[model samples]
Target: MASASSSIIPPPQPPRSSSYSYHVFLSFRGPDTGNRFTNHLYSALDRKGIRTYKDDKKLRIGDVISDELEKAIEESMFAIIVFSPDFATSSWCLDEVCKIIECKNKLGLQMVEVFYGVEPCDVRHQIGTFREAFQKHERKGFHESEKIQRWRDALKQVTAHSGWTSKNHPNL
Candidate 1:
């Protein structure tokens, strides 16, 4: 009797050179503008030959943190933050922003801030709706977290940097 023969196949390897002008890490609040604006931006980036990393997979039942997500952020060349009213309300988003900023300061990662439907001054001063969101979070006993303060500092830093503003941009 002849034994069945199996063919060996070589493991696939990642491309030596990524076919992307920029490796973009998108940061946004899923429930708020995540589905709409974030999707649009991702699509546009893809069209422009820019590789973007987005969290579209569902989280595991008990999965609170993702190593893959962090790795993607670390490997990205640029981080695009979608700043909206609900952005600061998310601790996860804030943490991601902090990591991006840390990479910016330490690893020299470039960042682009998208005000979405808000103004730069609001994010800078932590006033207006952003202030309200922080206030609510504070009332809910999340004000003391280091992440919150880091988020605030990131917002201020982003505002100080040059970036496109949805409210006052000539064209984006």
Candidate 2:
């Protein structure tokens, strides 16, 4: 029998770079928290002279994270994923999250998560809106089951890390 590795295709790698261009990569649901939380966070990071990559204005509307975005994520020193109520609904966001997790594992990239108006447990366990979002993905049946599972794994893995949540902090 043929070896399983022989038929399996490897994931694409980002272009080799000696140095990164940005200090941080911000991952968030644009319409959900773009105008308020993410905008403020980006401004704050920028004011501190922390170079950050934000995709809201950079990428044209596309089905998946473009190569430029993949490179941006790879080039950043750290990643901040803002898990809003609607985050999981977007496939691109899920793909980005999966890429972030891959970087964390393969490249030692650091990551921080912000639960914006959502509970950490919800994200960790795929409950509430997270569950609803996945249900939608399943119902649509457009993505391969394997791909959807990867998104779930990424969500669970990221939530396991220590991060911020807006549950008790109304001021934030």
Candidate 3:
């Protein structure tokens, strides 16, 4: 993974700020699970007054992630990564995951993974759909090589942490 620059990382976070702007920041591929599982999770979080951050599609502007999105991730106390089958296909999602990891490592921010129909092992090892995503990325000849490595490393790092898998109940 390439090193994140100051432009990507938000300003230095205060060491002892108990008041976070959000309770959770949800990360997922919009096309895959936005209407189904992610929407339900967002609704549940809202009902509980969790102060969650789910990107407003209307506010999204470009392929590159916006500063507002980065600030949201930094301000959130926790992050929930919904690893759907097509999650890796979108660079925006991958970049978000990378930033989530950065927050976790530097800010001691908490994160949990929900393997929504995808295997944890596949995410960790970059196999199956994950493999396909990487292949497509390589063929595109657009993304920086370092960024691609960063995405792979981010995937491995996040999957190493404790997470729930759909293996037990495929219906979920």
Point to the candidate with the largest TM-score.
2
lDDT of 1: 0.71
Residue 62's lDDT within candidate 2 is 64
Q: What CA RMSD would you report for each candidate? A: 12.5, 11.3, 8.3
* Model 3 agreement with the true structure over 1-172: per-residue lDDT tens digits: 0121111223334543678888788898888889987787777667656688898642467734568789989988888899999999998889999999999888877777888879899999999999999999999984688989999999999999867665654654
How does candidate 1 fare on TM-score?
0.77
How do all the candidates rank in terms of TM-score, highest first?
Answer: 2, 3, 1
Error of 3 at 148 (Å): 1.0
Local distance difference test, each candidate: 0.71, 0.81, 0.80
Q: Is candidate 1 or candidate 3 better by lDDT?
A: 3
Pairs that collide in candidate 3 are none
Of the two candidates 1 and 3, the one with more favorable TM-score, higher being better, is: 3
Residues 103-145, model 1: lDDT tens digits: 7787677777778778888889989888988888888888577
